[model samples]
Target: MDSSSEITFDGEQRIGIQKRSVRRRFQALLEELTVMNVQSVADRMAELNPIEGRSHFCEAVMRSQMQFPQSTNVYAALVAAINPRFPDVGYLVAKRAAVRFREACDSRDRDRTETAAALVAHLANQAVVHAALAWDVLMYLLTVYPMDNTAAAAGFCIECGSMLRASAPQRFTDIVGGFRRLLRGLVVDKPLRRRILKLIQADESMFEDYPAIIYELDLVEAGEQVTHMVSLLQPIDPEYSLDSSISSTSEIAGGGYGSDEEVSSC
Candidate 1:
């Protein structure tokens, strides 16, 4: 094995079968960050320039607010599913979700009572706060790694068969493919398929100000975006990814790391 090749989670799921890998990753992160004070993490997140999928995350938050409009289970499920591998992303998504949810509140608006204005403002502030915490978490980890070294990431541990929070996914063409496949698998409802597709394709992450484009589309039209984006995200099949799976991808034997309490709340 290469010196950098380390054991990470195997794919055996503990909670929901689909969630097992990410759950492991999430637990480790909370443990590691306990010492880092979440407030600092939030500050750093604000300075971040949005990444490729950020706009999508932001839009998803808004759509969740608009669509679900009331239930938080979807929000929690999303956070639970994503926070493991993409904690920063999850935090940002949370912040965005809060604002979107508030915006969707029929009782509140800029023109409404001062109480509504204050409430909306408060949620917006909280969004920024969460974003900062998430950012700090990422930056702190980045500092832990040697400036020139990439192998220091907690990365994946095959022994546990779970993804760990210590590192980000390495560059692989297939990562994009895998993400698309995962998103596709998440779609069951006909409406969800369209939203997922639009999210993948014309979303602002894919194209600037794409949200404007989305508002123009009817639900049926939006569904096509999912398929289009999947093709673009993975122009070729992910056959190569499976065959050339990252060296870090190994199966686990048993126990490792933190309590389930912090991670399981989702």
Candidate 2:
């Protein structure tokens, strides 16, 4: 509360209050954007136009198909909503949030691929497993098909528009399953295959009560990481390439999968 409200100063007091409210509103929007309902939004769009093999997730990713189009206007709105009265908390949060969010998504994709690769070992034919792994990666980086960025989400969107996309699908489970199918087509590594089972059956809440109980959660648990990351990415190194396997799954091979630059317009 500014002292202006108590004194008969210019309406600066009311203006300052409005700015505080605006900052709070902006922060809330970011949180909402983080929980973006990609599937629902895509479904709504499909009602008007259908895209085969492309889910809301894929469609949303496609906006990054040529760089995210600031698909969601949250960033811009936040900027415009900033109160001239108070410090720019909205700008500060937005600038850094985008960077960290991008890192989390990129790390999630890598872990998915690495886990897929490892599952291939458990399969029967090593070659087939490789192909399956490739497909999974293809699906993830599908928006920019043939443009591999497993080590990175290169052209992927890292802007405020990304908030418009849905939460990450459990593509990792599919990737792991696909790899299993590929290897199974070959010979079947009943023994090596055990690791795949261990991972699938393992606890997903590895970051929960007891991380050691990896046998509880499923593969999508990997995606759940973004939620944890939203809070922590700001403090940690966005490029740190966390390889603990327990958290990010893949080593910070390089940088994020996409760039906010791709969707600056949106």
Candidate 3:
């Protein structure tokens, strides 16, 4: 072969080898990541207590999520695995998924919205039913994504009420009262409203011991009075007192029962 042809052939061979090498390295990285099972990582994180350990766990999960954004199963497994032990981590995953869902909704991107919604729903469903953190995620999704046909608002309310019933007596008043007040503010459809009323009726046993006057009153008035009674039980924080009930619930639910700044500091 001529010197010029030999040189060209060698260059092409070298280029092919470089491309193959890059492909192999990419495949190796993907394999390593996939082998790092999300459930196992979550289990390990549960055993960890220190802030550093929690941070590292979060970082690892977040890194995996970034690498496999399309892997809804991984996200679902991570949420389910972490929730029973570390509810805060579960909330974090749900919150991230919700953010993505919101972005898709804003852009009117149906496919992306469906993907994000599936992830969010999986996390919500996997959450421990009576956990305050789980309720928070469920409630937040109901509030923000209400217009979506697949948002499952009624089902979420039923789940929330069931969880609230199972909660401690002291917490029942706060959670139910807060939830009622939240409902009064939303412009929900008739069917949704009726479903909520049915849930409240099912929990009537909770308030059976209250004064007869409460029962005589209409649902709205009764709910307001109940909320007032519970509000008295909570220590009056001047700062929180000024905020509306919906705002307070949103802050607590979205930020792990604390302000965003407070949760982030931890």
Q: Give the alpha carbon lDDT tens digit for every residue of 1-266 in model 2.
A: 77766645345544334333332332223334322342233223233322111121221232322242222232222222221111122223222333433343456554333333222211101111122322332344434322233222211111100111212235444544554564567554464345444433432332132231123111223222111112221243322221121123111323322332433232
TM-score between candidate 2 and the true structure: 0.20
TM-score of each: 0.22, 0.20, 0.33
**lDDT tens digits, residue span 148-242, model 1:** 11111111011000111111234222333443575556544544344334444432243343211122111212222111111111122322232
Best by lDDT: 3
Off by over 4 Å in 2: 1-71, 108-266
Local distance difference test, candidate 2: 0.29
**Candidate 3, TM-score vs. the true structure?**
0.33
The parts of candidate 1 lying over 4 Å away from their true place are: 1-51, 98-107, 110-266
Best by TM-score: 3
Winner by TM-score between candidate 3 and candidate 2: 3
